[model samples]
Target chain A: MNDLRTKLMEAARSHSPSDAVPIGFEKQVMAQVLALKSTRQPGLLRAPVDAWALWTRTFLRATWSGLGVVMILSLGSLAVPPSDGDDSDYQGLMVDSIAMPIDETGGEIL
Target chain B: MSLLPEPSAVPSDLELVHAVRSGETERFEELICRYQARLFVMARRYARREDEVEDIVQEILLKAYTRLETWRGDAPFEHWLMRLGTRICYDFLRQHQRSREITSTELSGDEVDWMECQALPDGRADGKADAARTLVARVLDRLSPASRLVITLLELEDKSVKEVAALTGWSVPVIKVRAFRARLEMKRLIERLDREKYL
Candidate 1:
């Protein structure tokens, strides 16, 4: 197996494609480069070229999400009971706050 | 007066790259003319069809052009370009791996004879190098993409493990491991071919 492997490697080393580069290959590559240059932004300028597009996309997404959150909050607020002009609720809250326990150090006990 | 023209100093690859980056795009052709033949030779090893080789070369060149900025000047430009070329060739191998099947019908009579010649006592097959090459290519086809890449680099290209690791971005130990498995895979492929031929 080792000998066969050596022979195979020898053959591979000896074998190379005799064909040269196809004629006009350089022209084809040059043409491609030229076309690419026309479309592709230079490295220095690419970031700026994409900046506006990226900003527009980000801004639009943020606007939609903000509106969505607002809509959800508005709908949620509608589900909650509205408070009447009554001092009773405030009076009960004030009593609860006064009745809460406090330690000597002024930290609330858990 | 002698008819011979004066020898002019050619621009270096780094200089040409700088020129292209500085908006002198035409200078890129100098780089292409300098390296295209070498790239074609490398691509030919991975792809048999001339058209496929051409496409691979084109892709490599275009990629080099687009990513030219990423090439730090610490290394030689040829090394950078060849590394890119090797990676593209590996990708081409993987992309075409599914379509490149090694069937019995693919081998020619000479290739079969070459395979049989291996079992002989002397194991000499003169004037059948092409057949050996074909057989090797077939066996390589049977290997997985990573195996094929490792074998091609280690054996066919005569690259050292360190060099292969550098070109492939694989660590030295990984290249060593892959090369060992690749050789084993090649041996199994050749044995299978011989068995099928006998049966």
Candidate 2:
């Protein structure tokens, strides 16, 4: 029995796992897991409130979403294309109003 | 390396999971540090080459991260990792078998007896122990990866059938059958060696 146990332990001892992962393996794994979050659709809100009622509510939401698509399509058709007339003012300027650089004097913004 | 951490490290594996879910990185590192050895042990049984085992373990770690958002946390974290490791090992074996890379070498007494001596060390016969140990390692190399895994985990690790079944995703019947066949094969090898007057 002692021999058997010793044999078993010896054979088994070779199976011990090695330790040497990236210093921050958990962070890396979590980062990958977090990436999966974007692909996951959020669970239904107030899921199946009352099976029949929930079905009706979902139907309504679908109708609303379809209507939203139609509305955007209509609005998109009404928009005008941009004109070249606005390009001259910005092309001649050394800087734009929102993006001025600090001057060497530090007192002035150019 | 030390097996367990100091008692004051923090909370349980679940607490670490909660931290991970809350987007804290430290808890996740703690979780990995906590499990790396256990995972390596699991991976060792699946892969034939030590390097390959390490690779498989790293792949499993990557898989765990990618699949973790689905964790329901209804079970222990170690249990989940155990299951993951088992499944990964099972899949690795299945893939290897499917690839048809089985070695054609015949089993010999030198391999079996040496393996027995190294592993069983019964009362320590010191004169030839080193030679026996090497022979045993060589003989083990002759076994199929799946056989090595089942034998190591079941006979050596002392994991129960239910635990193995759960970890391996194999129904209890399959694990039983595989373990039974693996042991029978080992016994046959030993008997053959004895008949050949090598023992």
Pick by lDDT: which candidate is best?
1
Estimate the TM-score for candidate 1: 0.75
lDDT (Cα, tens digit) per residue for candidate 2, span B103-180: 213434444445445444353445545444444444444456666567767866788988777776778888888888
Residues B1-199 of candidate 1 have per-residue lDDT tens digits of 8432343488777778777887888889999999999999999988988889999999999999888877868899999999999999999998988543455557899998987898899888997998998888777777888999999988888899999988999999999899899888877777666777776
> Could you give candidate 2's per-residue lDDT for residues A1-110 as a string of tens digits?
33433453464464454454546555655565455545552531112235788889999999999999999998887796657697778765745755665467967644
- lDDT at position B53, candidate 1: 96
Report, to 2 decimal places, the DockQ of model 2.
0.12
Docking class of 1: acceptable
The C-alpha stretches of model 2 lying farther than 4 A from their native spots are A1-110, B1-11, B22-27, B97-124, B127-137, B191-199
In model 1, which runs have C-alpha deviations exceeding 4 angstroms? A42-110, B1-8, B99-105
- TM-score (all chains, Cα) for each model: 0.75, 0.55
